[model samples]
Target: MTSGKAALLIAALGLSACQSVSQFADPLAPDIVREAGLGEQILNSGDPNGAVRYFERAAAATPDDVAMQRSLAIANMRAGDLRAAERAMDAVLASDAATPQDRVERGFIAVRLDDWERAGAMTAALPPDLDTARRALLEALVADRARDWSAADAAYARALAGAENKAAALNNWGVSRLARGDASAAIATFERALATDPKLFAAKNNLAIARAMRGDYALPDGVESDRERAVLQHNMALVAQRKGDAAEARRLLERAIAAHPQHYRAAVEQLAALEN
Candidate 1:
């Protein structure tokens, strides 16, 4: 199947399994609530364009519904219509009908827009219990981007304490440490992150880079068993190329691309680097 078809199938399967799609009616139920629920169903079923139309209708029919607005914003974001997402979020923010959940959802949207300050402000409005691990992760990213390393570390520490995003927290914390000239500590932290979540692609990717930086080429322990083994092998080949073994690099790269034909970036880049 085509990648898009596969993605749509997965989306449809996921929606079919979700209680949120089947059990939860729109907050207002009946009237616009029913329409909103149908819209969300369509969105979850991988038809973002159709979902947007329904959500737009629901939002217009009930302008006071912060929930519908939030859903519309999320649909827009998923459809890669950033401008529409921004408009929907703005509409939600302008509405006095917003609940804490709305604020939190808006915070998430702000993070996607790279408006860290706005995200922080919206997150501040969320209740403590509702201020989730995701919110903390966004705060950490914002702090890290702004060069507030201490705050970033603290936020990541808090986020990981919840145990939901342990891998991401550890990986980002390692980056914070690396920025501070602590290569060994960064490596150790990344290793710990990998141990905590073996399937975390970002952690694995960063770990490889960190190891390469230290002139260490050993593969991380879990790669052989990973679903991303092909990608990992490709990364290893790139690393070999960097270490001046063009012949072995080309061989490994070819092996990886053979394993996963969709793996293009690594194969293409390594091929160019070797030929040059």
Candidate 2:
């Protein structure tokens, strides 16, 4: 898969920008909560590195605060500091007051770290009644990672049944199919995701990837933020690269990086590789 495609798949499965400190019910010091709230705002504003600085201070002030630790972990993850995220998540998980969501986040971190054993164990231990959709989705992810397509499919079906955001489940299911080398099924799945929620930019980008993998040049159409448009352009560039149009690929990648300097790290890396 192209770098852009790989990045999109990772983004789809990873912690999203919409995640809030409010999701956790853990009681926190007022000072720590205020600091963590500022960190979350920074994270949502597209500056994970900046968010990490604030979150770290909050976590340091309240060493035993699970909520601060969780915020720090997410900020570090967003900043692409997996080791920092792992440490923070471990702290959260070790806390006696860790919430169910905390466990789920730890499982997610394990998945990102490719610690399949821990991921499976953590997710498997989740309360079946709490956040059923998330549990099912995580189970599907683990099944997909194990290359158990049948199990993945079953889990994905359950996820769809319980999900409040069916579009996200559909997009993830399509990504699983794509990983299994079923471009046709993946394309159809992405289409269904888009039909379910037209504003799902990730699904639109994934649709472009599936089509490109099938040797189609047509780009997916949608209205999006400048960053999202950059991502779409990066995906098209990947398609061009795969088609042996190196010049066009280079142009598009460069354009994508220029369009969103703060985001699109994969595009920057790809452009650098092309130059080298």
Candidate 3:
């Protein structure tokens, strides 16, 4: 059988006994259970190293336990151990006790690994509804990476409508709109994201682009308070060019590059625009 077929077969077989496998010896010894609780706190606190040790001990005691395995997998991924993460995912998928959520998370790892074909195939098999929304988001990410603009736009819109302000979803959704020449709508979406989180670098950078497209020199109100305002000013120059004011745009671009010597794209484009 092909890899895709093999993966599907594995998914089908593993899903059959998910409940039973998850019931494997609960690694809930009083001390260990306390550790497990603390691990969750650490995970929530974004301390992957602390969480990993707790999860590792929990998995060791409940070797075949699906929940422990899932925790282990997530901790490993957070700790940047991709190989260990894949191994945990394999164990989770091989058991008859894996949940639909397990399969979805496996698909997530595949996407992070840039295994788009596998992500597409695995997500295609997920149950619809909430699962479908998650899959749609992943497909949007894959499509964005692959430069399939139309599919990406549709997928992201679906995901955003279902889960508002999901940072990655929102950022990519705006990207798809920008890709398709829907600058106004893209700008709106990007700005909404900025409002949701003032310090999100990707949203800030993207919002700058959208503002530049509209021929505006303003940074997203207060974003420049913390971030380098040179980027915002540089983007404004591009907006000037877009609005057919090449001279003003060139001057602004030159000023930006002078202020920040690393603004290579702005400098090159401004010089080229001047020549033309």
Candidate 4:
């Protein structure tokens, strides 16, 4: 794929951002309790967009409430509204009640935003003696962003040292390996991640990508949409081309064009370029 297409493919895969939220419980607060509780319920039901309105109301009712703001931030992040998440997190961190975990959360948001400096600053703002898996996850992410492979690997090792949920960090590390052109390592890392958490869809999809990089192109079962199939085929075509298998690339591109619901301009253009 062209760099633009590659970037879009990675973005669409939704692999970059990863975080956890505590299970929602009843709040003792009177004014915003109902709103916040409803928001968490909606969010837990996997309706982040639906949760946002309730979270907004709760945050509005108690502007400086750190827990409410944290909930809102998580909801916004889950909904892919990074800007809104940043705003909500800023509110949380500004409050006196912000915890060390909140600082790491803020740093993670910064990493997702590609704000490396702010991410580093957030990491620095945390208590120097604080050692947690989330903090190490942020460090790995920052190192990955900086293309410091050794540092990233070390940080990821630290992140997974004793963390019960090793899948997410392993997935991130696999992505970094893919970025570094280590398809074999990436495949192994993704497999490890999936072994840790069979429910991690990102690891499964990424494993497919890694396999395709080696010219073993096969679409995952989870890719259902016509457009999604087309995108995968187009990406696999690019991978084949990079591996010097022009014929395989052409075949995959043809399949992509056939699979698309509408005129698939990118695949068509790639095919034309290959023909030339």
The prediction achieving the highest lDDT against the true structure is: 2
Candidate 3: worst-modelled 10 consecutive residues by lDDT: 17-26
Ordering by lDDT: 2, 4, 1, 3
lDDT per residue as tens, model 3, 130-219 = 434455666676676576777878887787666534654566676556655666877787777667666655667666665665556556
RMSD, one per candidate, in order:
11.0, 7.4, 12.6, 6.9
**lDDT by residue (tens digit), candidate 4, 103-218:** 77777677667788999898778887877766777777677667788998998898778455678767777877776667788889888987887766666667767787666888
Report the number of the highest-TM-score candidate. 4
> Which pairs of residues clash in candidate 3, taking residues 3 or more apart in a chain or in different chains?
17-96, 17-97, 18-96, 18-97, 18-98
Ten residues in sequence with the least summed lDDT for candidate 1:
18-27
Better of 1 and 2 by lDDT: 2
Off by over 4 Å in 2: 1-47, 223-237, 240-276
Pairs that clash in candidate 4:
none
Model 2 whole-model lDDT (C-alpha atoms): 0.71
TM-score-superior candidate, 3 or 4: 4
If scored against the real structure, what TM-score would every candidate get?
Answer: 0.65, 0.67, 0.62, 0.72
Please write out the lDDT profile of model 2 over residues 110-159, one tens digit for every residue.
Answer: 77677889989888787867746666777888998788989999989998
Clashes of each: 0, 0, 5, 0
CA displacement after TM-score superposition, residue 150 of candidate 4 (Å): 2.6
